[model samples]
Target: MNTEPEQVSLNDLAGLPSMATLVLTVNNRHARRILADLSAMLDAQRQVMALPDIMPVSAWLRQAGDQWSFASDNGLAAHTVDAFGALSLWRQVIIEAETDHALLDVGNAASLAQEADRLLSEWQLEVPPALQTDEYRRFMVWRKAYRQRLHDMDAEDGVLGFERVYQAIVDGKLHFDFQNLVLVGFNEYSPRLRGVIDALRAQGVAIFALQPSQVDAAQVERVQAADPDTEWRLAARWAQSCLRANPEGRYAIVAARLENDVALAHRVLREALGADGTAPAVPYNIAVARPLADWPLVRAALCWLRVLRAFLLHGRCEPSLAGAALLSGGCAAHVVEAPAGEQMWLT
Candidate 1:
């Protein structure tokens, strides 16, 4: 038996069999890009066929968990909660604790605590005793309450969910339909994840890690710019040239620190692509994500809802002048208008 990592190109995905499973990058966006690249490559090769089971790691894990839950005899699925549900429970625990003392930023605190709990489980680390810091003590209390709450609800978070699925697979309670599994763009795996993969391999499943081929030295180029703005401008120009050279070809311009500089990069790219002032759609897309509440429309909607709730509860909407202005700007009609030093009452 030969033991060597499989070397596969993006073009190789075009030849994957229907029964094969392909696990892509951990990031959904990166997985989508890989899929798009594979599609384009297959399209260029004139191969029109159904692709195999392809998904990101997160998606694949969720699918595996669902499959395990469905195949298991016990009703373990009903007791499992996703990440969001787990975070909601953590927030509830923190809120309950806040009744005793004031806590700064409950949402952020819950998120951090949830992440710490996940990391502890992932790394198989025990909570260290003798944490003398005030914050650590508080976190310990909150964690105790949170665990009690989970016990009361008979719910397990994602970390425990993964472990349960792993055990199910080991005990032959879980089975996958695919005989062959291909992992792509994965650098490392946590112990629990590795255990599950090992269990699958033990069950006569063929697992292969697809190693990316190296790029030729002549084909690679490095550019040094004076500043970030210059760097983005150059990138935009390069992308524009690539599109001009091959109008039918797909391309992506990756920017460093894109979340911080999306607006500047967008402006530069639009200008470079000659779509700055035009009403026509832009040729490229930026993939930076923002919080839902960060969007102006969402903020306005939430503010209006809050105002309405206030009005219904106390027969008055007591939104600040700034909030009133935001409401007016978002809606066609002003819901609450507060003038200078004036109390506006609604009945």
Candidate 2:
């Protein structure tokens, strides 16, 4: 048996049987692009059949876990906790570990600790015993407590779930229905995930890595601008020119630090695209993710909630809180007109 995974180009996927499953280790956006290209290729070939199953690794793991649960008697599938649940549990453990003093930032600390724990699991590494720093000791204690909580709750996070599935596969307790498994955009894999892939290959599953097709190098242009504003404006103008040349063609403008400079990029793109101070009906799409709390509507809702909480706790709302709620445009005329002694509550 070949120990190494077989490699194939992206174009080679067109020859794959429709039953083949393509798994991607990329974000949703990149996955969508790959899916679109694959669909277009199949359409060009006039192949009218069900497309191959393409999905991200997380979704594939969930499907595999479900299959394992169905085939095996083990109840490992019942104890899986999602990312949010795992974070909440980690925060709870951190809070419980705080006996001397309160943490400066509980949320940030929890996030970091959870990431550290995940890294340890992913790399299958043992915690170092040489350097015994105060923070490290504290984290070690929190980690122990967190694992104990998971044990008591019979819960496992994503890392543990992957390991469990891997073990099941290795022990011949799990079986896959598909014959072909195509891996895409997977530059690296965790030890446990790699183990699962090896076990699948051993079971006669055809594993292939989709490589990028070789092409001539594109022309590179470097432009020095006064600042980011000028840079974005120049990019927008270039994009507009491209659109003018090929009105029906698709294009993308990539900003490396888009998340950090989303507002600036949006403003610059809108102005350059000839839609300023109005709803941007431009052909381009700007995809930037932000926390829900950063949205104005969510902020307004939170302000209203704060006002309601103050009123419930003290039997009267603070003037500052009420003013904030009113200014947020979250308060209605009925709320403003309600009598002070009416015992109002926000539903």
Candidate 3:
């Protein structure tokens, strides 16, 4: 481990070229595409899987859940792993859910689980039993089987995946030629990524971490009143200010959390900042979350599918709901000529 103080400024690396390579997690791949048209990407998710124990608890749950339909005790809903901190949080949530199951033993179960987790941590092991019961036995059985399959998949994909980048760094095959690496709007970095960054810094590569500027506390509360998720809003406002400050400036939302927030913030800020409510909309460079069902094509396809299925199964058309699904696209388009050719029906 390097003992030197972490270089906080890009200027520290003297004589290094000012041009930088932006590194990002796989979720932000879209944003990176916007920023660097030609820059190569190593999927950080793939790379992080090099550590088998840390190989995303979500993946484990998916595999295990598929094999045995072990529903969570409290119906723990599935969610997207968009943020870095979510992995550990999800693991804890799953364990807690397992502990809460009625089938699991209740007598000193929590204390036993904590002790088991502490022992596993001390021994550098991955398995953490949540209860001393038959359910725990069943879970371990499934986990052992699932882990083998997961490991096999990791082996097949490991070579070309992000894991290669970390391996190259470890093997002294990966080295940066540039002097500066400026991370823009990255809130968190994985341990492997941090290691790679440290290695680059050790070799005189100046790293500068850039974050979105925050509004004052008074402004923050006011903005939160309008929209509770202030992180994206403040970012949107900053972007709006940037464009206003410099007409040529550009803004990119990289791996933004809560996809809805990105669009909402953009619309709100753009209208507020634009003069006479007629300014150009916020430039969202990356693909943000918008509902696919909202699209005309998707809606039409869904409507047609639903109508055809209904007619085939029930031998009748539910016009009220089906008509709504069709919207302006007339029933004529959906109607298919019957086999007799004398009559037509929605097929």
Candidate 4:
């Protein structure tokens, strides 16, 4: 049975199957509220049982290795694209009847070959007779060398790969002190995550997952016929109108592609406002991704800095530096050559 927010008090926590560790998968805003509520309940009781070491899953992973730097301590972020690429290549290789013929169609033949070899070693699958071909034999040699490189890197305390971390937990090499574990708001779990969960269960650790189902049933009907060019702008204007009329009320602009449409709406509204780029003074909580790499202002500043440094040191700047800056700042049309012998000094 799922525990309700109000029903789960500090006193009632003692009766839960496993209260030693409570791992919650919550957004930062909701996490703060939950922490505050838990603290209040403890204060009211004026007593403590085995107070669970509550934490988010990612935080818990870092704590297990006693490392806080995600970039330096782990290669998971760096190799994410590569790992996915590896899987894609594996699917092609394993599925194809004629491996050599299939490889001819691959854009990155080298990467496909490399991943195929890695799979042979890491996957631990028996080699089928169909794969025992001249093309497969050629790929095996490169895979052996790559496997050695991985082994050497591991011996030298290299950054832990994402798969490696999952394997460690499953193999009982990595563990926390918590005797019992509780997971909150974890509805969907990846295969690696499931492996770790299964391993924990095998260790006799009581595990519970509290997942609350959330569904959005709001619908939008276009008052006018759809025009691809102006539909988004019209929607933004409507949203702006609604917010302006009722400043105290909360509103949401639902879109099929929030990441793309919300960003476009923000720009459209800003443009419609004027040169000052001021929109309606309404609070917005855009439920979309804002990846750091996609932040134009920050990217523009970095590119500008690089250009400045390059010109100062070498008496010339790469075209890319200026190009990146101009594109980021939305002024690509006005990009001009850097003045010769110009010195830029920062105090």
Candidate 5:
């Protein structure tokens, strides 16, 4: 409640693309040896995390009394706080398909297909282009011709089990959020994984596209065409209002809190309006409809919400941030709104 201006870092982070997860696999001959190395990781357990409402943007941020802790929503017992790195491994799968895509392999995939299953099973990996299946034949043809690559660098000790790599991510305990979800480090597997990304998006989850590190062509076209849903254009408008030096700089696709999230919607507004500034005054117009007669506290609240409108729509209601600045001086927001029958517009 201090009169100081809200720090930049204090802003809400609701929407943003998250970092990506990876899958790793090794050659078939090394499967047994790799499994032994992974045996040690099996003891590490997964802790369940809960999603909470009424909390800042994430349930993880909600503090319990004086203690910082979170409970599980899925009825899974709470264990030691999960290391973010380790948690990510569980989110993705690693498969080590043989990378050979030579033309001879393509021609022989029909004959070699039978051997794929055995080798893969021995390696504890899957031989895709399901053997004897149409996809299996198709994949064989593609592998020898249009190969789809997956990223899986060699482990320092040459031990490779996708499960072990996933466990390593969980134990890493790195910072993560949905925005950090991206598709990176995978090149050859892009085409097939493209399908996986599309499926996740259909479920309302925005994930990295098949091309990874690239923006959605559809979304970009919509924005360039100035579609209303393409709020990318609005970014510069909001940034200009906030007096940001380079509005486009904040246009990163991956961010913790973006305007799309309902939770962060009015936060900037409330902060900016309560602060003082010589901002452009609301263009005055006599409301012939309202008759200017309203209740006491109700009228006061409406006025406050209107003040909030400026900040919300424009990103900052303050006339000048460096000058008197938003939220400066001991003050509280108080204002009124027009009656329900009529809608009002700001100047």
Candidate 6:
């Protein structure tokens, strides 16, 4: 996904999220590659979260195999230990094995968890009481297992993987380890993706927003059919989501939709990125979209995630891993940050 040989300094205004703090990514390999490669590049004092589930820091250790790291939720390591248990060897090994076997950075809510209730409840969705207990049990098991790994790691690392990654990248927030926090799942930006973006901003971390390329041109046409105001709102919502996620960092979002109206595209994007960090903006960038005619090629992408998921459970990844790796490039992104000066170190 990182095309350039040297570090790709993404100076793109439209592609980067303005005044945001964390970059919530979905692609597994790029996330891993970025995290691992950047970990050393970042100020050691700051936190650089290596998503154990995503491409993790442990992946680089030849001798460590799948037992060197731990998986914490929301980058909060202590809570995970409290919820799961003190020593979770099985959970620790699984998280490590899954990462070693394959590198996936996305957090898919639908299939990842055994019990749907735990996730839905977190989303603030109402679940049937009858199902809550069952889901709660499943959630408890998963949470407990998840925490077991955290208890094994350095306690200060935090429980959220998103936080860990963000802490690693920011310039000013560099003091302790890049409180690399991992914001779990794309759902965070789905329906209320805008709200999610806003929320990340509130967190105050480095933001990396990604723009996805269009898998279907028809979808773009449908989007164009909506009123300009509605379109602007949608764009604004999209931008807000990224801004919120990465208040201090940069973010990348792919406007993968296709259309010829460059002017309208600009207006839509401006509305999305907003003006001041708070919100309020105009046309920002030329909303460039990526288009492909190959149906199979496109369909394969939608399924690329499954390949990563499979690799997580089993060790061998599909041949599709090559193509799946490119999805991030197909999109655009926005970034925000403080002036980078001295390397930061955490207390």
Top of the candidates by TM-score: 2
Of models 3 and 4, which has the larger lDDT? 4
Candidate ordering by lDDT (highest first): 2, 1, 4, 3, 6, 5
The parts of candidate 4 lying over 4 Å away from their true place are 1-19, 26-33, 36-51, 67-150, 154-162, 173-175, 213-231, 241-245, 268-280, 285-337, 341-347
**Compared with the true structure, what per-residue lDDT tens digits does model 2 show for residues 1-347?**
56666898666766778675665555566578667877776565577645677788878777777777766465673477888778867877887679678778887898999898888777787656786788888888998999888888888888777767768887778887788888777778778668878888888888888885556748778899999888888988888777767778887888899998899888877777765564344566888789886687787887787677667756898687687676665456635655542444443
Per-candidate TM-score against the hidden true structure = 0.70, 0.77, 0.35, 0.50, 0.16, 0.24
Model 6 — which ten-residue stretch has the worst lDDT?
A: 334-343
C-alpha RMSD values across all candidates: 5.7, 6.1, 15.2, 10.6, 28.6, 21.7
Clash pairs for candidate 2 = none
Candidate number with greatest lDDT = 2
Candidate 5 residue-wise lDDT, 1-347, digit = tens: 33111111101111121133211222232333223333433444723222111111112222221021122221112222222222222111111233442343322443344344224433455554445776665545533331111122111110112222223223332223232223323333322233333443444443431222234555442234355333433543444454444423433233233434323323333333233465432111111232232444444444454456556656765443222222222224211223321232223
94-136 in candidate 6: lDDT tens per residue?
Answer: 3554554442532332124423423443344655767778535
For candidate 1, write residues 1-347 as lDDT tens digits: 54333666655555667566665566776677666776766555577767776778767777777776665374573487777678767977897788978776776898999998878666666545774678777877888899888778888788777667667877777877787677777677777667667788878777777666565755678899998889989998898878777877988877668889988987998788874453333477788888886787777775676577667656886557346545445776543443422444332
Cα miss at 340, model 6 (Å)?
67
Off by over 4 Å in 1: 1-17, 20-25, 29-50, 70-84, 98-101, 125-140, 213-226, 234-252, 275-282, 300-347
Question: Which model is ahead, 1 or 2, in terms of TM-score?
Answer: 2
TM-score-superior candidate, 1 or 6: 1
